[model samples]
Target chain A: MKILVCVSKSPDTTSKIAFTDGNTKFDEAGVQWIINPYDEWYALVRAIELKEKDPATVIHLVTVGLPDCDPIIRKALALGGDEAIRVNTDSSDSYYIAAQIAEVAKKGAYDLIFTGKETIDYNGSSIGGMVAELVDAPYVSLATLFELNGTTASITREIEGGEEVCEVSLPVVVSCQKGISEQRIPNMRGIMAARTKPLQVVEPASIETLTSIVNYELPPAKAGVKLVSPDNVAELVRLLHEEAKAI
Target chain B: MSVLIFVDQTEGHIKKASFEALTYGAKVADQLGTTAEALVLGTVNDDLAALGKYGVKKVHQVANETLNHVDTQLYAKVIAEAVTASGANVVVFSHNQTGKAVSARVAARLKAGIVAGASSLPDTSNGFVVRKPVFSGKAYANVSINSPIKVISLNPNSYKTVAGEGTAEVVALNVAVDASKIKITAVNKVVGEVPLTEADIVVSGGRGLKGPENWGVLLDLAKELHAATACSRPVGDAHWRPHHEHVGQTGVQVAPNLYIALGISGAIQHLAGVNRSKVIVVINKDPEAPFFKAADYGIVGDLFEVVPKLTEEIRKMKASA
Candidate 1:
């Protein structure tokens, strides 16, 4: 089985958010970037676990970003991916990114395509479905569990109040989240092995973007917390009803 | 062309989020100087005309049993047909589980520009610009959609659902529904519990409460408050709670009217999901916990002591009222 895992770079969970260029650009000055947690922890890890169960399986990592994102791609390889591919482009648009990835998947003809349900950064869980449409394949989103069968795979995806179990054949797109698999850290041997893995960079096809960022801003700073002592717990309830009107 | 809103319903009951979408779509339609209409896929027992209170001028109903449950492909086909038949210039969705699953496919089918997790009405003064949260609510991005046909999925709890004094004309839409390629084996569920997505108030706990055995304390509080129960990602990871109750960047992103968090440190990821709540209250033993900064109210004390007392206070207050 050949699985293609989509990866993206996101600001570290603890990094303080700041924007540059008059709030038009994300300030990378003091930010630490890591492979998006959803991609690394759920999608990629689940694919690697499937590969571990079958020696014939191969996992490939793909990302659409600037060359600066290669280190993150390499780290994905160190974790367990057999190879890495970078679609050279700016990922400012989700549809354009999906088209580029779809073009790559059409050429590679991967049996399964994996992506995080939504990127931790953009939080737009659209690409997998877009790519699935572009490639004329089935798409499943928010998958929390996986069980593969011959030629077809049985998948379980989260719904409003429960889970829906479905069976789809190969050459499908799946957007995964937590509970699909456990996260794995790269050991010294894996890191050394990743150094020798194939890292390919390809140009993005001339795909037109339907959306563009006209501006940027930050959420209003939470006006500091209202404190009520533990002994004044009843007062908290009073404030909730009278002041906050939350209840 | 009219602005079409997908009014999502489950077992004949229109979801609260869908009402938000209708209100949002109506406002957007008024902005564009067009009519606002709704499209529902399956048969419903509720009075479809009542939806007009949200400003929808019409409700388009497709009486199909296959759509009782969400089938992404089937939904995409029907909605695309509705868009064409109604000549809808723009489509709106709630951006919940069903909307998140189907909106993209509809966009793909129609070759339209799509924006998910939209938090504000579009600034159509210059084309169509939408503002949405990015970096897990840590930041916001304003995107411009140039496509004549556009798809937008509104984030739940972001838009206000207001009613207007009006009546809608219910129209039956005829469209060919396609057979589904996938088969659903079974649906696993936890009955008699409020779905986290639709809960107006939520009570969540974290590692500070210590273990799964202590969940009853918070659950009791949640029961008294008539709220849903939730937990931090770490608690879910430790298997102390079911993964579905986990709310964070990688888990469920909820925005209730009132979110009362206990014992959870405010990690950026955790803050990403719950920051959209109308009011946030954090209770923890540590005074300096990061969650306090984002909370509307903070209580520094043991949750074990504070929660039981808080629950008792609520019970007495309710009895008196």
Candidate 2:
């Protein structure tokens, strides 16, 4: 089985967020980057688990970014990916990225494709569906559990108030979230092997950039908290009703 | 030039998020000097004409049983066809589960620029610019879509639903429905008084509550407020609460109107999921807990004592009001 796992780097969750260049770009001056948690902990780890069950299963990591994304892809490789592909481009538009991934998926003819539910930075949650549409494959988002049997895939996804169990044929796209797999750390041996694994770079497909960022702004800062004394519980309620109007 | 809002439904009932989308779409239509219409797939039990109260001019139905459950492939095809037939230049959706699953595919099919998690109406003064929360609500981005056709999915709870006195004309739309490639075997629904995503207010607890045995205090407060109950990651990890109730970076993200946290230390991961809420109240015994920094109102006291008194005060307030 050949599985293509999509990987990307995001600012570490603890990093302070700021924008640069007239608020049109994220400031990378002091930002620390990590493999997006959903991609690393759920999508990539689940692919590794599938490979462990069947040694013949091949996992290929694909990322769409500039060369700065190499270290992040290497970390994913260390986890268990057999090979990696980098679409040499720096674009944040979801359509452009999905189109590039679709081009790769078409050329590779993989049986399954995986992506995290959404990148933490953009939080769009649209890539998997867009990729599936471009590739003309069935897509499932927010998958919590996945199992493969022969040519069929059984997947469970979270809906509004419940879980939906679904079955689809091979060559399907899945966007994974938590509950799909646990986090894994790369060991010394795997890290060394990753250094030898092939890192292929390819040009991006020619796709029109659908959207552009005009500017960025920070959320309004909170007015300092109103510290209600523990003894005056009724005052808090009065404040909620009269001052904040939140109740 | 018309705005078409997709009304999401599950088992024939319209989702609360759909109402927000309708109101938003209507306002956008007013901005564009056009009419706002609604498109609903599958067999619906609700009064479709009454949706005009939210400002829609008409409600279009496809009335197919297969669409009762979401098939992303088929839904996208039908929605794309509907958009073309109706000549809708702008499409609106509530960025809920169904919207997240299907909107992008529809946009791809129609070759339109799409924005998910849109926080505000498009700024149409110069061009169509929409504002959306980025970095998990830590910041905002103004996005410009240059495509002739545009698709937008509004974030849940970001827009308020406004209903006025009006009735819409219900029309049946003719569209082709393709067979779905995926088959749903079972659905396990969580039994709760309020669905977490749609709740206006949420009451959450953490490991500081001690254990599952002491959850009654939280539940009682939630009941009085008519709010959904959620938990921090550790509480969900320890199985004190179901995994669905977990709200953090890797769990469910919520933007309720009011969020009350009891005993949570406000990890960054937890804050990412809920920083979008309009008002936050934190109650933790430790004065230095990180949650206090993000709270609009805070009380540095034991939740065991503070929660009951707060609940009682609210009950008395509600009783007299």
How do all models score by TM-score?
Answer: 0.97, 0.99
Model 2 interface CAPRI class: high
**Considering every candidate listed, which one attains the maximal DockQ?**
2
Scored by lDDT, model 1 comes in at 0.89
Candidate 2 global lDDT: 0.93
lDDT of 2 by residue, B1-321 (tens): 799999999988999999999999999999999999999999999999999999999999999888898989999998988898789999999999989979999988887888889999999998899999999989999999888999999999999999998999999988878888999999998876688888999999998899999999999999999999999999988999988899989999999999999999999999999999999999999999999999999999989999999999999999999
Instruction: Kindly list the per-residue Cα lDDT of model 2 for residues A1-247, writing each as its tens digit.
Output: 9999999889999999988888888999888889999999999999999999999999999999999999999999999999999999977688888899999999999999999999999999988999899999999999999999999999999999889999999989999998899888899999999999999999988899888889999998899788999999999899888888888
lDDT for each residue of candidate 1 in A128-191, tens digit (9 for 90 to 100): 8888888877788899998899779899999878888998888788999888998889999989
Instruction: Return the lDDT, model 1, position B163.
Output: 92
| Candidate closest to the true structure, highest TM-score | 2
What does the lDDT read for residue A49 in candidate 2? Answer: 96
